[model samples]
Target: MTTRDTVHELLRRIGESDPEGVAELFAEQSDWRFSWPDEGHPSVPWIRPRASRADVAEHFGALGAHHAPERNRTTVTRILVDGDDAVVLGTIAQTVKINDVSYTSPFALHLTVEGGLITRYHIYEDSLTVARALSGDTGPDRRVP
Candidate 1:
């Protein structure tokens, strides 16, 4: 498949929350880097330089455990592809219940795929917003944690 086709398929699979399909798009020993800036949340800076298939599985599974993937709607705004690289800009509206309080966070992801596999994933969102949501803070969501 062409690079654009591959990336489009991969992004579609992810938005569909089909972990199995997403995993199938990656190489067995592909190097994956996912970064979530110091959002003050424990899950921040989750860098995986060389994430294997097992690691990918665990990552998606953990996401499902934390907040049902089906509940987080992924809407793609744009996707640009060139050769073996591509960038996907999308938004995720998630409803997460933390400490009995429901937290809804809107976030964006910029993904880069190489050799028909995802190589990097960078998150763009309001850090304080995420921190407050994760910590169940209600004070104007000012502090990071």
Candidate 2:
């Protein structure tokens, strides 16, 4: 499959809450980086940097532990692909299992595919909203009017 097709498939697997399916798309030593603070948000432990396919699986595991992936929805607004690189702009809506609070955040994901496997993955999202949701602090103060 082409890089674009592979990325689309990866998104499909993620939306299906299939971590193993997503892991299949990545290289054995892929680099995954989440553009969020490494400290102060212990509730969202998966926000830290991840290297290797195992780390990727652990990141997804942490996400499943904190949120209901079956109920999560990701709407890809745009996808730009060139050569082995692809950029996906999307919005993710998820419900925190702990407090049943929902949060929607815009996100940008950059992916690099090499030899039919994803080698680099970088994600940018609304970390504050995620942190609040995972921490069970869905107060009015967390929302911007």
Candidate 3:
């Protein structure tokens, strides 16, 4: 399958809440990075840089432990592909397990597929919203300027 096809399949697996299926799309030593800063709010323990398929599986495991997977969805709005690299723009809506608080954030993901396996995965999302949701904060009553 092409890189784009592989990415779409990965998304499908994620939607199905199949961590093992998702891991099958990546290389054994793939690099995964979630670009959330370490400060501003309490760091999400599971949102750190990871390498290897096992690390990726553990990352998803942590997310599963903290969030209600059935109440979470990622909607892809656009996809751009060039050779083995692809970028996906989407939005994620999730409910925190602890407080049942809901959070939505726009996200952009960059993926590199080689030899029919994903080698690099990087994601950019609204960390503040995620932090608030994870911390059980209701956020400010009004939007920040």
Predicted model with the maximum TM-score: 2
Candidate 1 wrongly placed segments (more than 4 Å): 37-40, 43-50, 99-115, 122-124, 141-145
CA lDDT of every candidate: 0.58, 0.83, 0.82
Candidate that beats the other on TM-score, 1 or 3, i.e. the better one: 3
| Candidate 3, residue 23: lDDT | 83
What TM-score would every model get versus the actual structure?
0.69, 0.92, 0.89
Give the per-residue lDDT digits (tens) of candidate 1, residues 3-119.
678777876776676767777877776655434442335742222333676666666655555555556655677777666666666555554444433344445555556666666
Q: Taking the tens digit of each residue's C-alpha lDDT, what string does model 2 give over 74-126?
A: 69999999999999998989988988888899999999999899999988888
Q: How far off is residue 47 in model 3, in Å? A: 0.8
RMSD of 2: 1.7
Rank order by TM-score, top first?
2, 3, 1
The segments of candidate 3 whose C-alpha lies over 4 angstroms from its true place after superposition are 38-43, 139-145
Q: Distance from true position, residue 73, model 1, in Å?
A: 3.1
lDDT of 3 at 12: 89
**TM-score for model 1?**
0.69
Which is the better candidate, 2 or 3, if ranked by TM-score?
Answer: 2
* Per-residue lDDT of candidate 3, residues 26-140 (tens digit): 8999877786764334536788767888887777777778888888776899999999999999998888888888889899999999999999999999887888778776757
